[model samples]
Target: MQTPTPSPGQAVLAQVLAMLQPLVVWLLRSGVGYTELTAALKPVFLEAARAELARIGGKQTDSAVSLLSGVHRKDVRAFGQTARAVDVRAQLGKPTPASQVMTRWLASDWPDSLPFSGLERSFEALARAVSKDMHPRALLLELVRLGVVLEEEGQVRLCRQAFVPNPSLEESRRLLAGSVADHIEAGVHNLSASDGKTYLEQSVFADGLSPASVQQLEQLANSLWRDVLAAMVQAAVPLCEQDEPAGGNQRIRLGMFCLSAPMELNAPNNNPPDGDGDAPHAKDTR
Candidate 1:
């Protein structure tokens, strides 16, 4: 018997698995076991099944949900029953202590550098201002370890200009899951949308750049995004405080990220001539 050719759906599923494998690894490292993952996944499947079935004008019965989700009917009902509690828990991310300190630090004004021992407007004061519960010394040590602050001459100075103080793998995965999911949501909406207006998805791509130039590009992107984020926070604060009319309030995720990866040898490559009529091989893929 001849082997069947791969379909487009198979290709898409393969790509999704490729993307999901890393997230699964991160989840495993973060102490989410396979059982926990399966339990967590059941709710997601039930939700998607219900939505799709409803969109198709079908009754969202337990059996129907089970059929659509490929989960047992009892499991589907259990997922639906537990969805509210899960949502409430999801709303509260249980932010790490270190992240809370960083958020509060960036919210307030501080000197470029401050002496650690000063009674007023000192590093200790700043840390206390961020969190009275955590010891200032502990906060200082954490900040230094995370490379968010520089310690020298009995003074501590801010290092990172953005919210990513710790830059831990777990934190990265958290952001990755959220932001990428939101992006995919927008993309899916646009896929079937009648109007041509698209979500704010854009990127700059270039290949054959020197390592120095890539570093320069990274710096440029970081600087611009920092300014943009500051402006967003400053401008959005008052607007966010205003009471909503009848329509209700809105939540948003306006974010910018900088990513760079070396081109892979096995990856597909297409050479396009630059303005100066040079066909340099490019390796970067977005």
Candidate 2:
């Protein structure tokens, strides 16, 4: 006995059903409602199947063919089951009645009771606390003395110009030594203490460099600060925010976050040009 071949119309119907099966499964898994799934899929598949029937020289008026014009029958049944399961859990996850999600968030250790507090405030408070041996309150006083902290609406903040330094001539000399060593390694042997001071003066006096370069340097500095600050804030802020706390690990995460990038990318490279007029290759800073 020979197996019977399916008609062109039957073959088109089978292809349409196969194409729609995965979409049906996705809708069920995504928790679409049974009524909604049926309503949405019926119109889409019916039109597609009708077009398929027309292409295969079949009559749309035939009842047997029209029955296959809707979404896959097996998917319709599975959608009902999946929708029921999701609906049962909808109330539990819904944000309407003050969700348990907040409860879980509050239960976990964040900086304070108000979970939606501004991140800047948390960061400023953490920076102040990490700076000195005193309490957060006392550190604020010290910061004010150093002309870095400011008061606004009873809240403390770091001043905008706090990142700038007024390094004395002596301290500048010491800092320049290390910077010179770095330049030497990069084949920029001409840099001296005078050259470092000249660069610093240019940076200080000029109407600021290009915004793109400044923004790039600021972002890089902030990124490095964030890594160090995050660990310090996690260990320190909770203790400070608490009314009373033990005193054990109380040290500033050693560097100032407000300072500018230690190395200036905008500064002209002073290295001697190679025979080909290309810049000398430098060792990786990292």
Candidate 3:
């Protein structure tokens, strides 16, 4: 009775499925309604469907070719074009015209500090580019429904800023803390510790945890910390991407100390006779 091993493709698919499963579960737990879920799942499901269709078609499977054979030919084609447009914009290091228009409106002189009216026009333009028959208002509404946008003082704006490419140390620590808070709020109570050191120890060195679980948690923490550092650097220092690494490393190390000191002091191993006198006290003035 030997267990059969999965092929490389199957192994990759399994990891993807595992990652996606938690997200799906979280969505269901958050009380997302059927209609909202359907709309949200549309792009993902369609992409998977198209991939599967091509897989079945052997080497001759072009998504563009297979898309035209389907009833929703126009939609598939439009999606492909929009994806290309987004890629080109990213490569050019500039926002799409719609993004620029929206940003200008955000920075404009509306009676309210936030500009919702301008966002509506930008959303319309974005929707039109996606599908000629698609209603911009509906698309915007859908985004709102999905909790990706917020309405304030008659102005619609992003619920959160886009990811910053690289971050400073202080920013990294803040982001990591924020991510921990978010996870706790979302019922991932396992990692909730009074201090950063305890949290890291529990997350990293806890007994009986699987290697896979440890790896996943480490990756999540690293990603969250990186995002925080990047945002802080962008806001406070605005360094070029090439100039970010040293600052980012310095900040992250500082953040680790800020978070870990309290936990280390509280641990049973504290006040060991062999401890180095030169080591900085947790409360020592910098």
**Cα-based TM-score, every candidate:** 0.64, 0.26, 0.27
- Backbone clashes under 3 angstroms, per model: 0, 0, 10
In model 2, the runs with Cα more than 4 Å from the true position are 1-138, 168-218, 232-275, 279-286
Cα lDDT of model 1 overall? 0.68
- lDDT, model 1, position 22: 70
- The model with the greatest lDDT is 1
Model 3 lowest lDDT segment of ten: 252-261
lDDT of 2: 0.44
- Residues 9-120 of candidate 3 have per-residue lDDT tens digits of 6986787677567556756776776689765554554555554456667442345434633425555555652422221211233333333333333333322233433664
**What's the ranking of the predictions by TM-score, best on top?**
1, 3, 2
Where in model 3 is the C-alpha error above 4 Å? 33-205, 208-286
The lDDT of each candidate is 0.68, 0.44, 0.45
lDDT of 2 by residue, 1-286 (tens): 9989999879867976885675567567758766997676554555555556777777764353346664565543444323222212222222221111222222334433221225643533353334434354554454456565565665554454453444543333333334433333233223323344322111122222455766776787767665655665455546655634554533221333233332343345633345534332232222
lDDT at 43 for candidate 1? 77
Model 1 — TM-score against the truth? 0.64
RMSD of 1: 6.3
